[model samples]
Target: HEAPSPEEHLQARTSPLRIEPPFCQQTDDFAHNSTLHGISHIFPYERGWIKRCLWVVFFLGSLTFLLFVCVDRIHFYLEYQHVTQLDEISTPAMVFPAVTFCNLNSFRFSRVTRNDLYHAGELLALLNQRYEIRDIHLVEDNVLEALKIKADFHNFKPRPFNMREFYDRTGHDIKDMLLACHFRGTECRPEDFQVVFTRYGKCYTFNAGNEGHTPLITTKGGMGNGLELMLDIQQDEYLPVWGETDETSFEAGIKVQIHSQEEPSFIDQLGFGVAPGFQTFVSCQEQRLIYLPPPWGDCKVTPMDSEFFESYGISACRIDCETRYLVENCNCRMVHMPGDAPYCTPELYKECADPALDFLVERDNDFCVCEMPCNMTRYSKELSFVKIPSKASAKYLAKKYNKSEQYIAENILVLDIFFEALNYETIEQKKAYEVAGLLGDIGGHMGLFIGASILTILELFDYIYEVIFPFSHVVYIGRNHYSKERGQYFTSLRKNCLLICSHIYQMLAL
Candidate 1:
């Protein structure tokens, strides 16, 4: 080798770094003052101060980040668990429909008698003071049959006794008001009733049954002619409950029978769907009830009133052996019935407003599926209301108004279950227990469980520190002489968290 040139020697002496031997790794662990890459070149002795600072920041940041995630996940889990738990334990509630089961049905007469139930137009007038009842349905059945499915009472076995008749034979009218749990179903279903009279309205019903006897059969056919309900109304303002009027006769042509054939078998009509048995009320023809009022005695009967009612061919009055008020055969509007009474009460409306006593609807065993969706009419004139479809969606609404689905579909106003909900307070409870077999809360602590699970997941994250760090740094991870171009560093995440907390406090103060 030739001797080094003078210029090369000069360059070496003037150079700030050595190009030969080991290269210094300044990216990590060493500064440019002393101990550079394990060589005492220009690595800084206090370089560890910066390193320690960075390490501390990174560790704290990562821990803070991880903690925040843990809190968020736990909160989410708790909320979810709460909802799930409620779902798991939910139960449905139901209602009843009748008083007795056996004698009311059986396809056989079973020694039962027929009694015509009449509408007292006066009663409607009385009710109008509180409600804006403009329309009425004209029919021969009880308000129950016209509005909803009938109820059922099992082993109830009520014995009929007329107080007047008893007094004639043994002396004394039934002192106690006949009462019974006349509404019940064998299965878990929705069975309820309602009375449409306005609050504090004066409406009276005729009693057709009594209790305290063994054989429900009328041995001597405890006789009676028909019933007449009386009403004192503002004819020009309020309307009848429901009935028909013949355009020609002006008197609705409702037929009447005196406990004889050619008339609807009152006993036969009793059952779970139509006229419930053991209950004081039963189904009857509107026209039949139109007559049969005693012009003398307690009722102050007026024959002229009968003539005017009869002239319309919609309502009238007649007489019978015992006592009778006047039955207003006229109804404001009439609609068909839907399905038989079910055993469930809807979860809408005030408790007292429940159809169990608030509506005039009657559930029956008739071919409701076919007869449903029937047109609503009054006094033989077509009405705005139409029939409902046999589908459940339709029927469900019908049950709410205590009318047939066929009727509900037509009165779309009531279809908004939420809207109707406001009409009544204390909705009937639905029994989630029977159907879903829910025992307690629907889903047990689902949110808590989910939160716990999220906690577990967070606990398993090994890179949590990095996530919590406020910032990351890159550095070579090899020895002083080794060179790795890039490495990562973590920075404090808690700083940002503290900032957020401080901001929240500021906002609250403001």
Candidate 2:
């Protein structure tokens, strides 16, 4: 419709029309190309653009910032959780105390060491003599743990063992045909267990042992003198608790170790997961293997010959001053006949002296003579092998003797077991089947590397987000925020950066 004059249109429209601003700018003729008010002219436009840009950037930045904050907070929560989780089973520090640990090597009963036993090959050969076998396989394990015996001396090896060699790797041949069969397990992979020998912790080349959590002497006092808790025939169901992480609950932690006579788990592959074997040695022995108990009851003893002593991990060992049946002096001595044998006359003088008889005497003196560690079954026997007292008995003793319950429980009870073990009148010593302990390979670097790689990547992602997205500033348009308290903030930032770097490094490693 054609509008009237400007004055008439103004008069007709009573409802004041909303006026839209002009899209283009206007200027006077005097305003030259070098306009002085151009900035002023663009000021309003810039304000509008600035506001819109600010809204968009700040909105996106706030969202991203919120998401990042949530992520970081969650990360910290999880990190603390994981740290706490790990705290339960924190890597077991060297808990094997220097207390003269009762080495199985010295036990009069299981007194067989690396030198005392036949090789797996010999045993296999014996089996060959009995049965027709296609290929006789012998897995070897050393009895006289060269390592455990010399643990006190050095942690250095001038020449490292080639872990892949045949002769060096073969351990002492344990002659338990039954254990060998069981070790074969369900997996009949001949290649997997080719005379392979596994060792636990640092204890290696130990004396062969039979059954249950083999006892060792240590300083850790539990329930009583740590020795007694382990000896009694009475076994308790020790609740395995998480001993590693700081978590109060032991759901997944290394269990609290306790002494018991027979909790198959304790002596089996796993149990009170406190002690674990470290390096594994697979050995095959061919020659004669004979180990005599040292003058001292301790299985791991200093060798007389420095060279031979050094080979079994004993260094700087002098001849024990208390050695009565000195093997070094009686070399090539033959076993005396029945009449020629030294009579069992308990006298101060050396009544009888021969290799075989002295071997028995020396070991008896080293360990306990009257209280032998062998089979103590008969009632009339002097050494009973039943000293381990029941908890009720110990408790009764504790109440009666007015002693500490733990003292009664552990120390006295263990003494009781020892007392019982020694009661047999004639303890017959024989070679029994040995079940060996093998250390775990779980916590090593090579195993954790794969899993750690993934965690490192996630850590890196967090860092890169912080760096690229800029934790402080919301946008490049204008500096809206600044992270102060430089030390902590930067440290966190650095850690994130480092984590990311490590992740990248892992990828490279991969």
Candidate 3:
């Protein structure tokens, strides 16, 4: 071959086909332009090793702090903490709460039939003896003796009895008990009250809103502006057979509960007592509560299959749970419980249902897992009382009712229920750490420490992926066409060698 010139030699040595690794060039460009703090300083040729080391130390310290704080924040968010806040709002008018009242005496002395009395007395005696309650003195000594003989003859096993029918037949009538009624300076009739069954047997609820009637509203507060009632709680008509183990019910009074129109009344458990011979005033404040569900709180939304109640509440859930337990164990339901199961007869009640209910209350209460409702309305009440039938009007009242002053004083009470103010209190529970807040905190820490944003983070990931997995044909050194097998073999060998060297360098650095 002829000797080549100097130009030809230079051109051949610096030919475009002469291959060089592109990774180093690409890395240098990325470092110069990247938004990551200290990256360009680490790679630049002019920076001294000492200055680069200092920058690396500072960047690494900041990154360590950021990581620690971010980890703590993430852990806190996962814990699902909550906060409750209370706020009061004023309103022009507020819906009056439902008022449910029941007589302390569940049955009339003269209204119960002999057979009904005997069966009820036997059941009561069995219950009192079984539960170690007070002695049962419901019937006369002669009747007691006869009951003992009958019990011995039948081995103390009770017969079936209809408790619902008995209660309906002998319970106090609303017409007779509500002697006077007024609402917001207007007269209210007994027909306006709806009948509801509760643990206290028959009870009456005003403004229940169940008969397609809208709830009553009040624009004013204080006594005489809401519901006013003069009730006759006839002490003389109270029968010993109707008393419960709890001595609180033995006193002559009316049990009253203030609740939402959509909720069912649990009178025996939630009611306050209004004693006869007193003018009782109940000042109520409406409260609306909103609670978060699941990961944030234990509150539950009302399910579509809520069968017994129009709305969901803790009290309603408890009642349903108890009813289900009773039906499952005893195959019967109580008079106060709502279900399609047959009413628990006196025999079954004494034998199975009562004990099951007791067990549920005393030991297995946790079995019912009734979570609170997410949104609910509640009433907080403040009560005050003044003695009624003043000395000046005692005689006139006695003459009008055709009863003695003592009898009137012992049998009559005035009840006034009104709002404390035309305002509603809101209680709300909220998440302390939300997803948005978490992301914000993380972003703030990232920017403060590494001088990086979301876009910078994406750019870093893209750079890494491109470096680790380049195109198959990209590893070739020269532009000479080769067989596919040869190209693939060279590509694999170069990639393996680069990865091995990178790993060795990382290990040595560590």
Candidate 4:
């Protein structure tokens, strides 16, 4: 063989060699046919353009309908609703066991004026006596710090009452007043405020000129002692206890009014995630002295069973039980507990408190030791002010009392509270399957009209899964082993041959 000439080499360099791509080239007829075959495996029923369009429409419509059904009926069945009418029936019984002064500003009467201090001091004394509060240590800064540290009845959240306005209207420094009453000073000594009671021989008197007396603070729907008050609420009536004041004198005269309501059908007393059915609406809408159905009675829950309560009166009792248990076991009382319980310092708590306290720290449920108190009705209250005249004014004395003026000009602030049956509804909250039932009903409708069942959903998912992941070729156990790269090609060839032979056999038979 002779070497190629320079002219041949120049020709080779100038004229580029043209090489065809693999058999699956984009424009090739065989490539197109193979693609159609693969597509046919995915969609066996799809044929022409019109058939493909119809299939697309069918798929979109079916998807839209399925989503609509799930969104509508599934959410509807998650929570239950029961109607309540406020006439000719007894309302649920509620109790008001205790009250909390929520705002730090409400305790600053000493800084405001001497009269404010005197009145607030006397009121603080009365409150300590009534509630048996051990200390009036108002958390001035980061009030929630203690609440964050300890789990107790005081932190039982989502309280039905709105105290924002109560504190806003009074704006009395309650902690200062307690200090004035207990320490007879401007503020309490950090060490002196051990128990919040009137000091021996220290009785503060409020002499608000004869025209006015220190705003007589009282409550209804709460158990009363001496000048204290509570309401005898019954069926069909929600008690709103508010303070009536002389708008002219700015005196607070708290009153309790009984209003009628239609009978309430308890939708769910399982109070875990469920709200106080009617109470939430009544308060949120500020619908005092008016009878109305719960506005949200027909509304569907976005996230079902969402309402919750962190603590209850029974929870307090359980803490007392736990305290008793501690006293029995370790001979020390926890400082966080209410009543005349002795304070358990940090060292004491560490030395004496059970390891169970650590266990129960952030848990949602109450004590496992003590069961809920039966026959005890629980109440929560909202304080609202209405303009009215002091009943102590002269309209009734000329007529003997000022009933008309009292009705019109007196500042009447009401504490509206409704009662509910108390029990452990946390863990035991039963789900109301409204949506599931609706789905079942839909299934029945399909069966009656279109011969379909919920199993159709399973079938649809299975079809989609098969399309995404088609079955692989069946290999004979003793066949030759092949590398992964060549195995796929060999399987495709075998499958194509089988299809062709089957087609030919059918053609021959025909």
Best by lDDT: 3
Q: If scored against the real structure, what TM-score would every candidate get? A: 0.18, 0.16, 0.82, 0.25
In candidate 1, stretches whose alpha carbon ends up further than 4 angstroms from where it belongs are 1-47, 77-81, 85-121, 124-510
Candidate 3 displacement at residue 99 in angstroms:
0.8
Supply the TM-score for candidate 3: 0.82
| Tens digit of per-residue lDDT, candidate 4, span 280-332 | 11121111221122232322222211112223333444455555556666666
* All candidates: CA RMSD (Å): 27.8, 30.5, 7.6, 22.5
| Residue 413 C-alpha lDDT in model 4 | 21
Q: Could you give me the TM-score of model 1 versus the true structure?
A: 0.18
Residue 335 in model 2: shift from native, Å? Answer: 35
lDDT of each: 0.23, 0.26, 0.79, 0.31
Per-candidate total of colliding backbone pairs: 149, 64, 0, 56
Report the number of the highest-TM-score candidate: 3
TM-score of 2: 0.16
lDDT of 1 by residue, 103-175 (tens): 1111111111121011111122212222222243443244334222211223334444332221122211112
Residue lDDT tens for model 3, 300-406: 86483457766678778778888989989999998889979899877787788778887887788578777888999999989998997999999999998888999
lDDT of 4 at 447: 49
Cα lDDT over the full model 2: 0.26
Per-residue lDDT tens digits of candidate 2, residues 326-388? 333332212111112222211111222323343553455553122221111112112122432
